[model samples]
Target: MAASRKVAVASVCLVLSLILLQFYVTSLHKELRAKILRAQITTFMSGLISLACWYLYRRLLAENHTVLACPSRLLWTLWKSVVICFLLCAQVTYATNLFFITTDPQWIAMVCYICLGTLIQLVCCLLVCDLIEIGLRVLRRGRQYQQNQISLKAQQTRTVVAILIALMLSARGLTVGLSPPPLKKVTIPMTKLPRSFDGLTVIQLSDIHLGPTVGRSRLQDVVDRAMATKPDVIVIAGDLVDSVVKKLGEAAEPLKQLQAPYGVYFITGNHEYYTGDVDAWFDKLRSLNVQVLHNEKAILQNHKQPEDTICLAGVDDNTADSFGYDGHGEHLDKALGSCDPDQPIILLAHKPSCAKRALQSKYNVNLVLSGHTHGGQLFPMIIAAYLVNPYYVGLYRVSDHAHVYVSPGTFYWGIPMRVFTSMEITHITLQATW
Candidate 1:
């Protein structure tokens, strides 16, 4: 109970930083940058040192240095993370226009004085970061995590990923910064689908945020899991690659290795829109024999009879702010226009929030597949997902018109630890209830 209160307090303080930063930006923009940057640098250094300590501590456990990895080390790590909490508060406050520096906290005076004070603060912060880090470890990992024998090498690899991401983002919130991009597999139920193909499984892997973070090894693991199911069709939900396909082009080889009786297909995620050319990824997936389904469309046919079909629809990410749309990325009703409404339809939507409209439009799409959440890749963020996507994770019957399944995802994005959650390679055996 006491610990819960502390976490709650920390969370509240963290949120307050945002409110404060909003004020700082609108009013004290000039004086705020230096103070904030100083805070950031101090936080960054603490994070680095804490990361190093944690690396050593975890590696020690891996090497049977459990005894040598004393409570003291844990204490240091905890202290650092706590300082991280405070800095996160300040940083968010500044980033979001919440800070209101005293009108007299002048740049000329504060810059010089703050520079010297920052130096002193830096030294003190370093010590505090170390102590806080150690204390956090003792309280969190050392205390609660009684059994800790896992892969040291994997832990190290993930740890390095964590540190690099932290440095890149200056995020000390430390709930595992970002999650691996989600894998969306289009599961089309073949049973009773005029296809006469019963229990046909389609392994859908989508939004594979393949970037500096998502590498070949993890992706190959995804392919292996997908293939393990012996899918009849493999449908990529969309946003197959978040950034340049270059980092994951070689990784695409594994995707090419994917085998299904039917075939593999891909669509687009909004990330592809913002970060990479969505059309090019479509071409890339096509080169690998994975059909790219844009607003146009495709029909999933059983090999035995081409006439037997499951109408499949794919669209650009559906967000209220998407550019292609007059407002919402691309409307499914228009995207799926010209479809045979009588036949069952499966739509690949990147953001699950579009479910309400899909139903409202009378598209009558029976099953919708989506995977933007990655079950909050971090942790509490899952709650945020609930704000936009009520079907945050797993299968849910939102209404008579739709059954939506949100894959928790196979790989993680920024930070690899899936605290309270497990990565899923959802082999949804699309079934006809009747």
Candidate 2:
């Protein structure tokens, strides 16, 4: 009750701030009536969203005749979803108001904007929820799968894991969000690269996670920092957003600004699969010249064009049902069936576990870039990432030939904190090996 009151008070203050800003802007630009009305309309929209959520809860889960064990699940889900929407609004509205962007008042435009924005955001929420549910389900299945092999009591392990989860959540409020430190840098030796590709600097970065918590301004700063290095080629491994497509418009704009002649490439992290809109996101990336490698492929020509040829192979996120008919996601073996043995190739797979398969395959890809760990996203959690990801965060010689680099994710998922992890923009150089 106290927290709700506090939020209500804060919301009222936000409305007042909007009004004050409107009055000030009107003084500077006299034809500000439309802007003023737009602010008022947005306020009304906020109230409607709040009320609609409340009514929805009352009708669905909070009603008198509920039978579910946790009827509040529906309400709680909406609550979390709304919080994310409002946070995004805070980011977008503040930026718009600061720049004095013209606010449109056309009823149709307003309706369409609201519908699209809400749908995009809701889709992202649904995406996150789906991944969580699926992960939990998988964990359950994995536990049952090994039940016969286990000699210890299952409850004992469950209790231990539960405590660890609680500790991670608690520590999240403690160590994360610290002025994150600089990214770690190390060089990899490429002894067998083609002579034309020697001393090639390839900047690698992954897991930006832009959304309710991490915003566009922060990403823009990172992008600027990355551009300052002038890398030969920029490769975004995966898990770029902490959240969904709703945040895509705001978050992606910053990434679009990162420029390199060789080009920027991306692959989907598990989060992308959760949203069920990876194809739409791929289309969006193509618009910005960021080549997205689905389990299939794309080609990046060397600067010499004639003398240079680099192939890119991207694998799909490793969900139980990701491949569909593409022979790329789940059926990764098929995706690499047509690799060229003589040419140098770079692969983007979301998880490091794919490294084992990638290493054994007869593909041309020499280096595989991946990020899903976020270095565990929490302490003790990285253990899970390590358990799941064949490589821990950073570069590793998985074998005598294949190389794997796992990025500590780009952003946080739900905790809104970063603990010991710092967001990274990598700068790597490729060399001409004999």
Candidate 3:
């Protein structure tokens, strides 16, 4: 908790520095000078609203004593609340007037795209502007032309160029964020993979995050794309929805269409426990005929050659135990205990950090699939994601016998933007090296 708070404080300081940088850059223009005060007020109000939302969310979590009483769960809730509140405040600040006009989700989303997109553009442009200024300083070192002084025309030109760069990048980011996740084909050669199970294709969809911005239409499109692949098995590693069943269940109805030769399986992501109704989501997915794996295993066999079989095991999110939910905790032992040691094992965990533990376990787990990092989801932020996750995205060969694949995500969450990262539907094929 203390560490999280310190990180939060550092983030606040960085944001303040960025705001100050924004003011300094804008002051160079006479027209923008007048708008600085207004911008400052907007930022202040946004901060206040974010604080209020954070407090309320924390209080709400506290009220849910059964789920969030634990220190770890509270800490997670608080951190999530901070992020959600910050984004909400950004949207509200950016679309202040639009909220009065209509409560439509589309309009709100449009406002979010425009506002957040513009903010991202502005931040990038400012950074570029600073870099240009620094380079000019370096070039002019020891020269007689007043140091730290740049002509208005030069500044304006630099700003214009930065704006152009920002526009291009933001446009690409929004396009990628809004588009259907592309299918990413990956083949993992397993030394112990059974001959019959060779060439087994599994489609992985993780972090779909169906909520206000991403809904039924988007989900349907993803489902259609996955079906087109004709995979042998389909797996939703975790984070399928961001909201409760009552809110996004209809949007998730497309899951019923996901069928494969083996089956469609799901495991809990941290977001599931955050929804405060993990069991409800389990029931909902089960109703859709999606096998919900809770620290359990399912034996996949080639009906034609019943002896050619493998174990497919899935565990709950790493943080599930912290949420104090009964029958919900990541238990690799329980999931893999009954599996035949000789047969290859494929484990599905939501977070990549679990890959290390799975590999170190007694079982000869051949492959592990996960997706929680979202490939960092945004620029600069991806750096943080990389630092935290052992495996950020894509395939990693942990050992000669084991491999791990981390998908960026099926879709994004919050802000409706994906800067340097992309959404993906991972299609993995298992090949027998033996």
Candidate 4:
């Protein structure tokens, strides 16, 4: 019991120390930016919140003479509270600055967002393991007579397994967070594919998420990968920018290098509206020769021969109007305007959820491409994503005639971790079934 108490104390101290280090780094950033008042406020609030969370955690974990006072009883409450607090902090800060402030917090805000998400996910994982352990114990209750006595060999084996699991998880997180995304070539066989368009190569770059953590250098690598595909068509499904155009314009400048025979196309994701000035990004992309398909359609023909052509249509994100952008909302009918229905059609919508809607529409959309879900971005959360998103991560045939491919994303978003899912540059080759 004393050893367990000592371990708990050490764990708490370690967590507190890490939080303090984050605050110190944030303070230095603020100071460098000459925001003295903001720095002071942040430091004060950090200390206060840290103290309160630690106090609550200690109280909740305290052992007592009763069964109800056990650590497992309060673990859920503690986990939920911490997660809620972190989520609130992240959203409130980002939204407040996005709508109200002229000058963004930049790198400081980025660090906080990433750190908070990482901490929350790690704690959530631990909480889940604890719940599983509790369930196992409950199942074994009253079966003490049936329970096998633990031998030293078994105990040591268990310890080794636990250590190995810890090491593997740590290594995976670091690798996924730090490594550049690799190109994944996927082939799609279309029954109605045009004979002339057979062997059509399309490169998809989605969810680049250029911000403080992911910047020009990373984006350049993605661009290089896309270019290397030597694709006939290049499409940026959505989420090309994580921040406002003014802030990440230079970061996205490498996109000029992306070229394809059929030209490059882009559609706005929900993040575009969230960045506050969606129009600015549209203009910027257009200037870089990226055709913005906002309720618009473009026909791609075989070497400019209009008779052998396929229609490529794109719509604004479904959530555009929800972000207060009225005319910028997704309009499938308008995007599919005057398109040849017999010809195979491809639709680019930001969210994979749009696949069902596309299939429901009269438009003969042969394929829908998307990338917003990020394949859940981390473990266990993928389960949550599955619950919410009809099409969360990969390819699915929405109907006999229509299919949707949800890219895992070209980069990480808020949390600097990817487990089970990968950051990928998707290269899709289309073949005619006939």
User: Model 1, which residues run further than 4 Å from truth?
Assistant: 1-192, 319-328
Which run of 10 residues does model 3 get worst, by summed lDDT?
96-105
Give the per-residue lDDT digits (tens) of candidate 1, residues 133-236.
Answer: 45645665443334244333334444444434433322322223233333344444332356365677767665566643455666777787677668787777
Minimal lDDT window, size 10, model 4: 61-70
Kindly list the per-residue Cα lDDT of model 3 for residues 1-434, writing each as its tens digit.
Answer: 99999999999999999877765744453324324434555577567545544543443333333323336866766755654654564547434332321211355655554455545555656566768877876776553564534434455566557656866877788888878788888989997787888899999999987764677888888899999999999999998876567777777888999999999999988877656566788899999999998999999999789988889999899765654456668899999999999888999999998877888888899889999999888776798999999998999998898999999999886556788898898989899999
Segments of candidate 4 deviating more than 4 angstroms: 1-114, 136-170
User: Where does candidate 4 clash, by residue pair?
Assistant: none
**Could you tell me every candidate's TM-score relative to the true structure?**
0.57, 0.57, 0.74, 0.72
Candidate 2 wrong stretches, greater than 4 Å: 1-181, 242-244, 320-328, 331-335, 420-423
| Highest TM-score against the true fold, candidate | 3
The candidates, ranked best first by lDDT, are 3, 4, 2, 1
Clashes of 1: 42
> Against the true structure, whose lDDT is highest?
3
The CA lDDT of each predicted structure is 0.56, 0.57, 0.76, 0.71
